[model samples]
Target chain A: DVKVTQSSRYLVKRTGEKVFLECVQDMDHENMFWYRQDPGLGLRLIYFSYDVKMKEKGDIPEGYSVSREKKERFSLILESASTNQTSMYLCASSSGPIYEQYFGPGTRLTVT
Target chain B: DQQVKQNSPSLSVQEGRISILNCDYTNSMFDYFLWYKKYPAEGPTFLISISSIKDKNEDGRFTVFLNKSAKHLSLHIVPSQPGDSAVYFCAASRGARAGNMLTFGGGTRLMVKP
Candidate 1:
C-alpha cells in the first residue's frame, strides 16, 4: 500500500517565523506535490516536483517554496509565516504524470 | 481566471438518495478529470476519474460523468451515507507531460443527513 507521511499533524508558528513542513513517501513515486486548503479555496497547489532536484510553482506559490533532494522526500518551506498562510497543508505523491495521487494526512498549521 | 469551478458551495441530501455535485472547467486541453472526497482536517482522497474519450466511469456507489464538449463533469453518489458528508473537489489535468499537475475546482460541501 502507498503511504505518504507528513512530519506533523498540527503546527503552530508565529508571524515572520520560518517554518518547514516535511513529507516522505514510501512508494518511491516520481512526482510529489504540496497544497494548501482553505475555507473558500479548494486544495490549491503550491509547488510540485517531477523529479529530484526539480521543482515547479503551482497556482498559489506566493508564500511557499519546496525542495525535493531525494526521491522519497519533499519539503515545503514558509520563508515567513503570516496569518494568511495558516491553512491545512497537504502532501501527495503520484507514480507518474497523472492526477491519481496518494495523499498524506494533512498538517494543519496555524500562523499567529 | 479560475480554470475549474464548483459553483455550488454546499449541498444537503437525505440518506439513501442520490447526490449530484457539479463542476465546470474552461480549459479545453484538459483530457482527464477526477473527483476527490475530503473530510475535515484530513487530506482529500482519490474517488473516481474519467477520460475524455469516455463519457462516464462508475466505481460502485460513485459515478463520474464527463461532457467534453460542455467542459463539465459531475459526480453522483448513490445511497448517500452520512459518511459521504464531506467536501468534494473535482480536478483536471492536461496530459502526462504536465507532470500530473492537477487544477482543482472550489469544493462543494456535501451534508448527508439520516
Candidate 2:
C-alpha cells in the first residue's frame, strides 16, 4: 500500500506568520499536490510539483508557494498567514498514467 | 464557475439500505471520474473510479455508474453500514493532462441510521 504522510495534523498560527507544511510519500511518486478544502468550496488545488525543483500554480495559489527539493518530499509554504487561510490542507501523490492519487491525513490550520 | 457539482449537500439512509450519491459535470473534456470518501480530520480516500469508455464499475458493495451523454455519474452503496457514513466527493479529470489533475465537486455528506 502507498503511504503519504504530512508533517502536522493540526496547527495554529497568528496572523502575518509564515507557515510550512511538509508531505512525504513512500511510493516515490513523481507528482505531488497541495490542496485546501473549505466548507462549500470542496478541494481547490493550491500548488503542485511534477519533479524536483519544478512547481506549478493551481487554481488557488495566491499567498501560497511550494517546494520540492527531493523526490519523496513536497512542502507548502504560507507566505503570510491570515484568518482566511484557516482550513484543512491535504497532500496527495500519484504516479504514471493512472491518476489515482494517495492522500495523507490532512493538516487543519487555524490562523488567529 | 464550478465544473463539477453535487447538488445535494447531505443524504440520510437507513442501515442495510441503498445510498445513492449523485454528481454532475459541465466539462465534456473529462474522460475519467472518481469517488472519494472522507472523515472529519482526515484526508479523502479513493473509493472507486470509472473511465469514459465504461458505463459502470463495481467493487464489492460499491458501484459507480456513469452517464456520458448527461455528463453525470453516481455512486451506489448497497447494504450501507454505519461505517460507511462519511463525506463523498465526486471528481473528474481530463486524461490528456500530464498528471491528470482532478476537479472535484462539493461533497455530499452521508449519514446512516441504524
Candidate 3:
C-alpha cells in the first residue's frame, strides 16, 4: 500500500504570517501536487512538482508556492498567510503513466 | 466556467438499494475519468476509473459508466451501505498531459439511510 503523510493535520496562523505545509510519500512517485479544497469549489490545484527543483503553477497558484528539494518530500509555502487562504490543504502523489494518485490526510489551515 | 459539473448537490438513498451519481464534462478532450470518495476531514480517495476506450469499468460494488458521445459519466453503487455515504467527486483528465492533472466537478453528497 502507498502511504502519503502530511506534516500537520491542523494549523492556525495569524494574518501575514508565513506558513509551511509538508508532505512525504513512501512510494517514490515522480509527481507531487498541492490542492486546496473548499465547499462548492471542489479541489483546485495550487501547485505541482514533476521532479526535484521543477515546479509548475496550477489554476490557482496566487499567494502560494511549492518546493521539491527531494523526491520524497514536497512542501507548500504561503508567502503571507491571509484569511482567504484558510482551507483544507491536500497533498497527493502519483507514479508515471498510472495517473492514480494517493492522497494524504488533509491539513485544515485557519488563518486568523 | 466549470468544465466538470455535478448537477445534483446531494442525494439520499436507502440502504441495500442502488445509488447512482451522475457527472458531466464540457471538454471533449478529456479521455480519462475517475471517481473519488471523500469524508469530512480526510483527503479524497480514488474509488474507480474508466478510459474513453471502454464504456464501463467495475470494481467490487462500484461501477463507472462513460458515455463518450455525451461527454458524461456515472458511478453506480449497488447494495449501498452506510459506509458508502460520502461526498463523491468526478474528475477528468487529458491523457496527453505528462502529470495527468485532473479537473474535478463540484462533489455530490450521498447519504445512505437505513
Candidate 4:
C-alpha cells in the first residue's frame, strides 16, 4: 500500500507569516501534487512536481509555491499567509498519469 | 469556468437503499474518469474509475456508468450503508498529455441514514 504522510494535521498562522506544509510518500512515486479544498469549490490544484527540481503551476498556483528537493518529500510554501489561503491542503503522489493517486491525511490550515 | 460540475451538493438516503451520485463534464477530451470519497478531516480516497472507451465499471457494491455523448457519469451504490456516507468527488483527466493532473467536480455530500 502507498503511504503518504503530511507534516502537520492542523496549523494556524498569523497574516503575512511564512508557512510550510510537508508531504512524504514511501512509494517513490514520480509525481507529487498540492491541492487546496474549499467548500463548493472542490479540490483545486496549486502546484505539481513531475521530477526532482521540476515544477509546474496548476490552476490555483497564486500565493503558493512548491519544492521537491528529494524524491520522497514535497513541500508547499506559503509566501505570505493570508485569510483566503486558509483551507484544507492535500498532497498526493502517483506513479504515472493513468495510475490512481494516493493522498495524505491533509493539513487544515487557518490563516488569521 | 468550471470544467467539471456536480449539480447536487447533498443527498440523503436510507440505509440498505440505493444511492446515486451524478457528475457532468464539459470537456470532451478527457479520456478517464474517477470517483473519490472523502471523510471529514481526511483526504479523498480513490473509489472507482472508468475509461472513456467503456460504458460501465463495477467494483463490489459500487458501479460507475458513463455516457460519452452526454459527457456525464454516475456512481451507484447498492445497499448503501452509513459507512458509505462521505463527500464524493468526480474527476477527469486527459491521459498522458495532462501528466496526472485532474479536474475535479465540486463534490456531493452523501448521508446514509441508519
**What digit string (tens of lDDT, one per residue) describes model 4 on residues B3-86?**
999999999999999999999999999989999999998889999999999999999999999999999999999989999999
| Cα lDDT tens digits for candidate 1, B1-112 | 8899999999999999999999999999989999999988678899999999999999999999998888999999998999999999999997876467998898999999
Name the best candidate (by DockQ).
2
For model 1, name the residue pairs that clash: none
lDDT of model 1 at residue B31?
Answer: 90
Residue-by-residue lDDT tens digits, candidate 1, A1-112: 9999999999999999999999999988999999988877788889999999999999889988888999999999999999999889999999875569989999999999
In model 1 chain B, where is the ten-residue run with the lowest total lDDT?
A: B94-103
Superior candidate under DockQ, 1 versus 4: 4
Clashes in model 4: which pairs? none
lDDT of 2 by residue, A1-112 (tens): 9999999999999999999999999997989999999887789989888888989889899999899999999999999999999999999999967778889999999999
Deviating ranges (above 4 Å) for candidate 4? none
The count of residue-pair clashes in candidate 4 stands at 0
What TM-score, over all chains together, does every model reach?
0.96, 0.98, 0.98, 0.98
What is the fnat score of candidate 4? 0.75
Local lDDT at B42 for model 2: 84
Query: lDDT score, residue A75, model 1?
Result: 100
Clashes per candidate, residues 3 or more apart or on different chains: 0, 0, 0, 0
Listed in order, the DockQ scores are 0.73, 0.77, 0.75, 0.75
